[model samples]
Target: MFRFAVLLLALLFAAPAATQSLQAQYEAFLEGTIWPQAKLAGVSRKTFDGAMGAKRLNTDIPGLVTPGAKEPPRRMRQAEFSAPAKYFNERNIGYITATGRSLARKYASTLASIEKTYGVPARILLAIWGRESGFGRVDIPHDAFQVLGTKAFMSTRPELFRRELINALVIVQLGHASPSAMRSSWAGAMGQPQFLPSSYLQYAVDFDGNGHPDIWNSVPDTLASIAAYLKASGWVPGRDWGFEVTVPASVSCALEGPDRGKRISDWAKLGIRRVSGKPFPEHEARAEGFLLMPAGRHGPAFIATPNFYVIKEYNESDLYALFVGHAGDRIQWGDSRFSAGWDRTDSMLRSDIAKMQRALEGKGYDVGGADGLPGFKTRRSIGDWQEKNGRTPTCWPSNALISAIR
Candidate 1:
């Protein structure tokens, strides 16, 4: 009993000592590593000290790699890659669309001026705004210094976060925003548009003309900054993002990717038609359009334009761009759902998908690194494998496909 009591007491004392040691290392890192980089980035010593002095390591943030640990950080828990339907939940979409429409009217003149200057549509800006932070209604509760500093000190992607930490310091030095006023998401995305500190420096705009870009409070600044980012990302003026279309069985689902673009007129020749029963605009006929099948053959497909890929620059996900575009459509037009429904499919673990991707890779197929998410490359590889095996191409992962691949 005496030995057990002494051992427990030792552990209790040792825990605090270990924590203090880590804290000391973190302070050293900030002074030796981060300070030099921030100095090189033109951040003043006062600004750097003011922003980072009291910051401590935030262990609660996701995907953190503990310093001096043997094993890597555990993969952050994510929602199951199930039906794509859940992504387009009616309640969430309805709320964003309804709120976006009201804001569109409220900022009509300001949006028009932004569109004239940036050449991105008002609806698109409003949709991205509504999606990003609920049009600045959502609380961004993390201090920029704490989140960035912790990630830079020790995280899965330390180098990337280190660069951003310096950028955050520069933002403070340039009088763009003070450290106290700079709130961010746990992932370090800041303001209404969820831009990183680097993106803020590169793309954020002072549309409200307040002598500085205040993305946190100024509505005009937030919207115009989104527009400016999209514009810089090669948003083509006078072109729609995409159209929901009916892809016939004759056309291969593997034909879906930004690189496989063809003139809209040529896709129409292959029996693709808009689900809305409207003709492809004559002006767009000559422009390039890529096939987009987010769910392979199991859900609605789209004829995406270059602008669709441009939207992906803000947040690199097919579903994210689709949600922004679809919500924008609802805000401008009316609340109508996708013409085709998402077919219910088997739920599989990401590990299962990764296993199947490895099998494909063993067979000389590029499944895009087997990261578990079915990107365009994975989807097309599935389609090609199905075709090779004398099966109809679904282009999506399934239990049967996983079994058959191996």
Candidate 2:
């Protein structure tokens, strides 16, 4: 009976022992696996040791699992999708636009120079700057090496983070920042621009001519680095991101993607008109535009340009692009809200949406990989499916449709 009690106690404490074993394995991975990659990437032993030697695993980072754990139950279903209306809280948008205007005046010459050099406008840069880190006012408070190394060692995408960790070491070796000074977000996005180290290496620039791309502190470097990223991603010079428009029902929301673009003039002919009652800019009229109904017919719509997609390259979310573009417009053109009101759509779990998407795919409709978020493909597929079932197509996801599609 005493032996049985001891065995029970040992089993009860086995979990902590397993966790300790995993942490040791992660440390070994750093020394053996990460070291070679960093060394091959030209990170010196001194810099590597300085940055990585004392770093402990940050157990607090999201999405971590035990080294030998079973495939975890899907937790994505527990996450509730927020309404787009919630994303555009008036107070938040107001703060971003208000701050953007002030920064625009304060950095007029620098912004003008950046626009001239990169062809990305000052308003766009200001909006991004405001969005990324409150134009550098927000204190990013994690050590880059600690966050990157921990993520690289134990994250869902370890290989990707391993590369990023090596890149971060390269940044340190280049003398751009000391290891101690290399602050980052918990997710390892660094500086005012919130660039991952690889992105920093690719796009960060020495705009202030201070011998370093000081995105951590220099306003010129932060704004210019953002412009450089947009330009590199093929932002169209002098072209607008997109225009808020009243998309006619006759013009199907299925037409909303980079792959399916038509001349703005052609869309105008199709009864798509700008909500402001102004004509599509004469130059833009001849250019291609894609329909962008983020919430399908359930919310505001847009006629997104190639430049609109470029904004998306910064952060892939449609709402993110819309927020940046709209905030920029507010700074440049003054306050104006979306013409159509965002409907109070049904809340859903991303997993349920993924299930709907898979069901749609099985029926020969493309829902863009069952990744949960409704892109143009998913939205159109939903609409097409609704029409097939003899229902009026809203071209958006709904709680009722979750069961209906399945």
Model 2 alpha-carbon miss at residue 393, Å: 1.3
Off by over 4 Å in 2: 1-16, 68-81
TM-score for all predictions? 0.97, 0.95
Q: Model 2: how far is 12 from its true place, Å? A: 7.4
By summed lDDT, which 10 consecutive residues of candidate 2 come out lowest?
73-82
> lDDT by residue for model 2 over 189-254, one digit each (tens)?
999999999999999999999999998989999988999999999999979999989977787777
User: In candidate 1, which residue pairs clash?
Assistant: none
Q: Which pairs of residues clash in candidate 2, taking residues 3 or more apart in a chain or in different chains?
A: none
